[model samples]
Target: MPQATKLSAPTAAPTPALPVRGQTDHLRLIAEMTREFTASHDYQTIAHSALERITRYIGAEAASLFLLTDNGETLACSACYGPVDITGLRISAKTGVVGRAVQTREGSMVRDVSEDADFGASVDAKTGFTTRSLLVAPLNIGQDCLGAIEIINRVDGDGLFEADDLVLLETLARAAALAINNYRLTEQIVQQERERHELELAAEIQRDLLPQPSSREFPIHGINIPARSVSGDFFDIMTLPDGRIWFNVGDVSGKGMNAALLMAKTSSLFRCLAKSAEHPGQLLNAINSELCETNSRGMFVTMVGGLFDPATGRLTLTNAGHEPPLHFDLRTERFTPIPADGPPLGIMPGIAGSDGYAVTEIDLAGGMLYVFTDGLTEATTFGGGMLGIDGARALIRDHAEESPDIRLKSISGAVKLPGQSLRDDLTLLVVEDMMTARAASMPPPRLEAMSTDGEILRLRVPARPDRLKLIRAAVEQAAKYCEATEAWTFDLTMAVDEACQNIIRHAYGNRPDAGDIVVDFIRRGDCMEVHLMDFAEPVDPSKVKSRDLSEVRPGGLGVHLIKSVCDEAQFVPPPPGIGNLFKLTKRLPSKLQ
Candidate 1:
C-alpha cells in the first residue's frame, strides 16, 4: 500500500478567504456618508464626502463619480479618488459598463475585463493597470438615470467579484439617488410658500377698503360695531316725504367676513328700496324674499322696519324675529313692548311672517322711541351676568330725557367702564319726539252736535314736547283715580296742566271711575267752542266756578289752577245716551313786545 501511493501533482494552497467580520462596521460607516451628504446644503461638501466614502469602502485603486449632463449621454467626473491626478475621470455613458448599466437600469460585472470585447481600453491605458474585475450600478431615480457608480481592480486577491461586494456597491447607488431627490423636493416647497404669502397679503388689503363704522350721522341714528374684524349688526335710517322716517334694524347670524359681506348687501338693498311707497309689512316681505333667494349660506337676519307717521303720533312697524321693542308712553310713564310676529329673515322663501305681520301703532309722546340690536341686552354684565331686555329697557328709562347723542354715549360708557368688550355689535336708534311730525294732512275736528244741554268742563291739552315726565305722571294719576282725559280746550288754545287735571275732576263731578270722554272742536267767527256730553246727573252752572278753598290739599287744587287760568270751564252731566265728557278752551300765547 505504501509503495502504491503515487506522488500526486503538487497542488497550490487554496487562496486564503478574506476576513469579512469588520465589513459590517465598514458598511454602517459607508451608510452614514449618504446621510451626511443628503443633510448638507452645500454641493461641494456633498460631492467631496461621497467620493471619499466610495474610495474607502470599496478599497478602489482609483474611483470617480461622473455627474450626468442634461442629455444623460455624457458625464464629467465630479469627485475623484486616486493618486494619479486631481482632474476628474471623464466618460461617455455609451462607452463602458458604466454606460451599459445606466442604459439598462441594472448592475454590470466584469471579470478578466480586458478579454471582454465591449470593454474600453482608454481608462486602462491612462491608469496603467490591467483591470482584473469591475462592478457597476446605475445611479438612477425613477426614470431619471443619473450616470452610474463604478469600482475597478479590487485591492484584495479575487476571482469573479463576491456576491456581497456587488451588493454593497448597489446599496451605495441607492443613497446617491435619494440625495438628488431631496434637493428637488425642497425647492418645490419653497416656491409654494411664497405663493401662499402673496395671497394672505391681498386678503389684508381688502379688509382695509371697507368703511369703518364710526362715521355716519342722521335724524335716526345707526350703530354697526363688529364682534370680530367684521360683524353682522346693521342699522339705517332714511327720510321720506311728509315727515316720515324710514328705518331698518337687523342682526345677521354668524361672524367675520362672510357675515360682514351679507350685512353690506342687506343694507345696500334697503337703501335702494327706501323710496318704495309700499306698506311696511309689504316692504319687509319683499326684502325677506330677496334675501332668501340669495342667502344660500343658511344665515338669517332678525329685523325691525318702521314707517313713522308724525301727524298721527303713530309708527307702523313690522317685525322679523327681532327682540320686542321697548315703547315708553310719555303720557302714562308706562312701557308697552311690541313683540315678535315674524321669523328671522331668509329662513323660508316668498312665504314670510312679515306679510301677515300686523302693524304696531305706537305714540312716542314726548319721550324717544329707542330701538336697538339684541347685542346690547345680550352683553355680559361686570358681574358675569347677562344683561337681558329688562336691563336695556331700564337704561332707556334712565336716559329717556337726554338727547339721542348723549344717551348713546351713556350706553357706551356704561359698558366700557367695566373693561368689557362688546362681544357682539351693539347699536341704538332713537326718535326724540314723535309729535312735531307733519300734522297738516289731518282733517279739522267736527264739533259734537250741540246739546245746549248742561254744564260740561272741557280741557284741551296740546302736544307737550318738553313736559314728558309731567304729562306721563298726570295721565297715570288720572288712570288710578279712574277718570278719562279728553281733547277739548276751556280756552281757544292749549292750557295743558290746568285743563287736563281740571276736566278729570269736574266733568265726572270728580268721580274717580269715570269712563271715556269725547271732545268736539267747533270754530265759528274766530270763536272756537268745545262741547262735552255725558250721562251723569245734570250739573248746576251757577255752582260750577265755586270750590271750597279752605285748606291746601293735594286732591282738589288741580281744579282751582284750571278755572283761574283757563278762559271757560264747563262740566256736562246726565245726557240720555252719552257718558260723562269735559269741555276745555285755550287762546294762543301772544309774542311779547
Candidate 2:
C-alpha cells in the first residue's frame, strides 16, 4: 500500500576470528582439557585440575567454578584456582555477573567492573582483593544450564577480556559441563546397584530369622510372602520342653526397609522373651515395653501371640490391635472370631495397662485356629476382587482336609497371581488341635492282656515304605511261634504289610521324618492278636472308608486289602502317649490252640 517500502534482509554481524598463533594455542589447550576431563571420574578432582589449567590458558590471574544448588536458589563455588581460596563460598543465584551468565545461558566480557551493574563488590571486600575486569561463561548442555565459570583480572596485554576470550571460555565450559553431567549419571547408576545388592542381602537375612517349616503332624504351621524385595510381616513357632508351643503372627505399620527392620526386631524380641515369659499376655507386655523404648518413628506392630498346650487342646492368646483370629470347628464347620484386645505395640510403654493385654482362652476341640495379616484379606483374586475375610474362610474350608503344609500352599496360591504385584505383605499361621480329635475318635480300652503279657514279637521301625518289610518278617515269625500253618502265616504277613503301608502313607503323610510305628504280635489263648501303634495325627475312622473294588484306580486299595485278609480289623483306644491303636485278630486252628 504505502509504495511497499522495499524490505531488505539485515546482514548478520561477522564472528571475530582469532590470530593464527592464538587459534593453534586454543586448539591445543582444548585437546589437553578434553584428555584431562576424560581421565578422571572424581568431581572435585576434575573441577580443581580443570580450573587451574583454564586460568592459565585464558591468561587470567584467578578463576572459580560456580554450581547451582539442588534448590536452584543459590550458587556454590565448587572449585577455584585463585589467591583467595574462594572454594565453598555461597551467593544468591541472581546477585552477580556469573549468575546472569548462567541464567541467560550466555557468555559475558566486562572490560571494566565499575561499568557493570551485575558485578558484586562484596566478595572482593571480604577477601581483601581488588577486581577491575571479569569474564563469565555459562556451563550448558542443550537447554540445561548447570552454572557458570568466572575469570577475573586478565594478566595479558591491556588487562581486559575481549570477545575472543569469551568465546574460548564458552567452548571450555561445554566440555566441563559434559564431564560433570556424565559423572553425575554414573554416580546415580552405581548408587542404585549398591542399594539393590544390599536389599537382596537383607532379604536373605530375614529369611534366616524365620523358623523352618514344621512337620505336617505338628499342631502349628505358618507361611510368609513379601510384596516387595522385603516384607513387614513375620511368624514364629517354638515348642517348649513340656510340649507347649509358643506361636505368633505380626505385621508392621508401614512397608519397605523401615517396616522390615521393625518386623525383625519385634520377631526377635518375641522369640527371646517368650522362652521365659509364662503366658502370652506377659510376653507381649515385655515386647511392647522394649519397642516403645526405641520406636522413634511412631511406628507400631499389630500382633497375635498364643501359648498352646497340645496335651489339653487349650490356647491362651493375647491380641495387640491385630486382625481377629478365626477358630474353625471341624464338626460344625463354623468360625468363631476372637477380636483384638489391646492397642498395637510401640504406641506407649504401658499401652496394655498394669495387667497387660487381656487374654482370651479358647478350647480348639478337633478344630483349627487361623491367624493372618490384612494383606491376605486385601489380596486381589483372579476375578479382580479383593479376598476379604469371607473369601479367606472359604479358601480355608476348601483345603481343610489337606495336610497343614499343603493347605497353606493351596490357600496362598489362590491369591498370588503370576506376574502381578501384591498390594501388601502377606502372612498366615494355623494351629490344629490333634489331641482333641484323637480323644473324640478313640474307643474305650478293652479289658485284655497287656502287650507285655503275650508279646510273641515286638518291633519298632520308622514310618517309611521301605521299612514295611521288617514288620512282615516279624509277623511271619510270630505266626510260627504260635504253631500256625504256613498258609495262616502267609495271610497274616500280607495283612500286616498292608496295614503298615497304610500307616506310612496316610498316618504320616509319607514324610521321612514322621516319628515311627510300633508293632506288637501277641498270642493269647486261642486267638492271635496283632497291635499297631503310631504317633502321627489321629485319623478319623469314618473318613477312612474303603473304595469300591469295581472302580479301577492306582491307589485307594490298601485299606480294602488289609480288611479282606484279617478275621477282624478295627481301631481301638491307644494307651497313654499314643496317637492311634489298630488291632487285627485271627483265631488259630484248633490243633494249634
Evaluated with TM-score, which candidate comes out highest? 2
Encode model 2's per-residue lDDT on 1-593: one tens digit a residue: 11111111111111222323377787787788777777776778788878877787777767899999968788999998756678999998887898898888998999899999989999876776667789899989889988899988776667688888888899889988887777788889889999888888878888988899998778899999889889999999999998899999999999888888998999999999999999999999999999999996889999999999887788999999999999997534689999999999999999888888989999886578999999999999999999999999999888876778888989988999988768888899999887433544434433333443365766777888888887787787777777788888888888888888888888898889687787868776778888888888788888777789999988888778778878889876453346677888887767834
- Residue 16 of candidate 2: its Cα lDDT? 20
lDDT for every model? 0.59, 0.83
Cα deviation of 420, candidate 1, in Å: 4.0
Estimated TM-score for each candidate: 0.45, 0.71
Q: For candidate 2, what's the RMSD?
A: 14.0
Kindly list the per-residue Cα lDDT of model 1 for residues 130-237, writing each as its tens digit: 556778877878788777777665655563466666777777887776675675577578667876565445335424432233322233555544545455777777
Estimate the Cα RMSD of every predicted model relative to the unseen true structure.
19.6, 14.0
Q: What is the lDDT of candidate 2?
A: 0.83
Model 1 stretches astray by more than 4 angstroms? 1-219, 353-357, 437-593
